[model samples]
Target: MESGKYIIVTGGAGFIGSHTVVSLLESGYSPIIIDDFRNSKKFILDRLEEITGKSIVSFDFDCSNQEKLREVFSTYEVHGIIHFAADKAVGESVLKPLKYYENNLQSLVSMLKISEEFSVTKFVFSSSCTVYGEPDQVPVDENAPIKYTASPYGYTKQVCERICADTAYASDHLRITLLRYFNPIGAHPSGLIGELPLGVPNNLVPFVTQTAIGIRQELTVFGDDYPTTDGTCIRDYIHVCDLADAHVRALESNSDEEVSIYNVGTGVGSTVLEVVNTFEEVNGVKVKHKIGPRREGDAAQVYADNKKITEALHWKAKYTLSDALKHAWNWQKNLDESR
Candidate 1:
């Protein structure tokens, strides 16, 4: 294991997971990735090696398989774990609720069970702002009560947070940090490995980039009749790298509480129109787009208070919307050339 603190990053090949892996390595930790390539590709490991100039260590298997995960625990003296292995498409989760429940819930349960068995203490969960569920107000803080989830995917995250809390409450060895991420957009600054969704893109930035790159013909604005400044839904879009840094910070911070929760976001809300416009302005590429009906599970407007995470973990988003869009476009261009 190269003689460093080993952290297990489940779903480490996915978009946010891959970026966090980079952050973990840069922060002097050895990240052991456990992924099944169900939603990601094996070539991401090569990309990681290329970006870090270090050999990447990873295993291919579903994390819900307790026996397979146990073998991994037996091989390495695991110090901590960051669980990100789950079906995360909100729209798909709505269409296939059973799939979301079975995969998202079971994988977490398995990870928690293995943690207790192996006595690995620290855990960082990849949570979402969807847990907030159409908050009554903007700039929602960590204390905000989780309201009605707009989709089954959001419900899975909400339930997973509860599962982590209850597990930690019952165990003496675990310290868990739940990071409620707002909209996570953009790619790594390296432009080597970024969001590479299979089939069709789910998130807005990817769809925008794909459209800009001609992989997709036009982007669809989900809703534009909402009561916002631009008559569209709003979100606090944080860069993937900024979000990744928060995971390292959470791992490094010391706290007595069994479970800690923080909101990771840029403390400002931007409308869908604003994001599209900003991308066009920054990349100098016209994204062919048109308005459409509201998506089944979408919150109208949600941002972050971010004071607690700032004061406690000393982490705040440092990337602007323009920077994120530019990086995302650059990543798309890189992907196009590689193809």
Candidate 2:
């Protein structure tokens, strides 16, 4: 938690990771990045430098590589780790369950081993609201039962949360915080870093951006007959920057607990049609979207009850949905211009 303490951020080049790196530097913490560039690119490092005016140190290493990860820990004076590396595509995870398990589960185990070996106790894990699979009640909370995983990726998060808990229980020195994030949308305010989906995007905001930028044909609003107020799937779409800030706060807390779980979301839910409408309003352009049949493994509605994190960490989502959409639009515009 000290100013000069070296904090290792796995998957630091990715969307949320890059934004968290910016937050870390802004908060006077020195962050060392570890990424394989499997899903992310090196351009994010340059973008981070541009945004924070600070040179970041990064290692092109996979968190699952035990030997290589050990070398990273030995080389750097890593005091804490904010783990963000994982395979996150829900649909792809269903097709490639082993791949998700390997990347998500193995990397987390390796990271914990390294953390224990090197005596780096402070840990912040990137968990997901998907762990609360199809909550029986609206506005799901931290105490909500971790239902059956909708996809392999969601199962990985649930597994990792258990791993963190078990690891902490065995080791009295370890302090782990699991942040169950809801749908993270938008980009950094500087428009230098944003969600860069490879090939095609599975998330809604990126698909909306791609559609607006003409990279994709149109946005497909999956399932228009869900049992929601709008008859469309509703999700608590938190801003990426806001989600990133939660990591910094968690890392700084320096608690001695085995594991603490918090839902990182705006206690509000927005439907798919509502998001598209907001995108159109924010960009001042109509989004070509169509209501499609419900995709397999898709949930009807999922929003967070972010009271625990708000009270425990004193962190609340500051940006509104309008702000998120505006930033996302700006990033999309920048992407278009660069292309």
Pairs clashing within candidate 2: none
Off by over 4 Å in 1: 1-3
Backbone clashes under 3 angstroms, per model = 0, 0
After the best TM-score superposition of candidate 1, give how far the Cα of residue 69 lies from its true spot, in angstroms.
Answer: 1.6
The TM-score obtained by model 2 is 0.97
Score every model by TM-score.
0.97, 0.97
Any runs in candidate 2 off by more than 4 Å, and if so which?
1-3
- What is the C-alpha local distance difference test score of candidate 1? 0.92
lDDT against the true structure, per candidate, is 0.92, 0.90
Error of 1 at 324 (Å): 0.5
